[model samples]
Target: MTKLRLRQLVIAAPGPEVADDLRKVFQLGKPFHDKAVAEFGLKNSVFSIGDQFIEVVWPVKDDAPLHRFLERNGGAGGYMVIFETDDIDAARTRLDGAGIRRVWNIDLDDIAASHIHPADVGAAIISIDETRPWGSWRWGGPKWKDEAVEGELSGAILESPDPNGLASRWAAALGIPATTHPDVTRIALDDDQTLIFQKGEKTMLEGFCVSLQSAMKALERADDLGLKSQGDTVWVGGVRFVLNND
Candidate 1:
C-alpha cells in the first residue's frame, strides 16, 4: 500500500499554561521533558497518548510559529496528525511525484520524519515518521506502554468549512475510501483508524469528538480531576477532549 496508518494527533497552543492545563485535565502524567528548538527558540513539552503524542510547543519570542498559529486560529483545535510509514523515502518519493512539497525534514539517525504543509493537505499539517525497533529520535516522550489508556486510536473528527472537498482530498491522499453517513463523512484506514470530516457553519474547532472504547469510564476519570463531561465526551481544561463512546 502507498499509505501509512494515522498514528498520532497534535494540538498546538499559544503557551505552556494551556498545555499544562490540558495535561492536568487529561491526566496525561508529567511531561516527558523540557526542550528547546532552534527554529523558534521555543520550549516544547511532549506527552504520550497511546502510540501517539500530544505536543505543546510554546514560542520564546513574539514572532514564533506557535504565536502565528494562535493568531490565526484564536486558540487550540486540531493541529497536526502523524502517520507511521515503513518506508519514509518511498512515501516522500510518491508525494513528490504527485507534486507535493515537504515543509521540513527531521534527521535524528534513529528516525527520519517529514511534514507536508497544511495547505498541501487541504487542512492540518500532516507529519510522516519512520522508526526502527527502538523508536524515532525526533520524538522523545513517555512511551505508549506508560500511558494508562489502551486500544489503538479509533479516529478523530474534524470540523471543516469545506468538509466535502477536504474529505475527498484526504481520501485520495491517505488511500482510504470515503464513506458518508447522515451527519458526517468518514475515511476509514487500517488499524481501526478513521477521520471524520463534518461540515460546519463556522470554522471554530468546537463540536467534534474523539471515539474510544470506554466512554463512560473515561469521562468519570476525567471528572475526578475537575473536568466536565457531556454524554460520552469529556472536556478537559476547555482544550483536551476524550471520548469513549462513539
Candidate 2:
C-alpha cells in the first residue's frame, strides 16, 4: 500500500518568543534549529512531537516569504501542513495531476519535498514529501527522536469560507477522498489521523488536534506562561492546540 501520513506542521511567528513559549508549555525538548532555512532568509525551531514535528519559522530578510506571510496574517499563526509518503514516485504522480502551483522544492538522497502555493490551495501552504528509511523526516533533524514529547499532532483544522472546496483540493492533491458532512469536510488517514475543514470567519489554520496524556498539564503551563488557554485547548503561535477527545 502507498503509505502517506501527516508528518509535520509549520507555524509562522513574528519572533522567537512563540517558539520558546511552545517549548515551555508542552515541556518539549530544545528545538532543532535548521541552518538550511537561512538560505530562504528564515530561521527555524523544530520540535518533535512523537514522530510528528511542529516548526516555527521567522523572517530574517525583508524579501522572505516568511515575512510576507507574517505581514498578511498580522502575526504568528499556522503556515503549513506536511504529509510524508512511503512511495515517492506515487506521491509525485498524484501531486502532478492536481494542477496546483509548487512554490519551492528540494531533492536529496534521503528525502524530497514540494511546497504547494497557498494561493492555489487556499488556507495554508501544503507540503508533500517522501523520505528514505520511510517514516524518517529530514526537517526534524537527525537526532529528533531525542527531542520527542509524549504527544502527537494527529490532526489539523483549517477554517475557510469555502470549506468543501478547500478540503476537496487538499484531498485530490494527497490522492485521498474528501468526505463531506453537514458542518465539515474530512480526509481520514492512517492511525486515526484526520484533516478537517470548517466554515469560519477567515481562511487559515485554526488549530491542531493532539493526542497526549498530560494535556491538562500543558494547559496549566500555557496559563503559567501567560498564554491564552482554557479547557482542553491552549493558544500557541496564534492557533489553538486542542487535546484529542479519543
Q: Which candidate is the best by TM-score?
A: 2
- Candidate 1 lowest-lDDT run of ten: 202-211
TM-score of 1: 0.81
Per-residue CA lDDT of model 2 for 119-224, tens digit only, reads 8878899888888878888899989998787778889999999899989888877888999999889999877889999999889998988887667888888888
Model 2 poorest ten-residue lDDT run = 88-97
- In model 2, the clashing pairs are none
Q: Against the hidden reference, what TM-scores do the models get?
A: 0.81, 0.96
RMSD of 2: 1.4
- Which segments of candidate 1 are over 4 A away from where they belong? 34-38, 134-138, 142-152, 202-228, 236-242
Clashes of each: 1, 0
lDDT of 2 at 126: 89
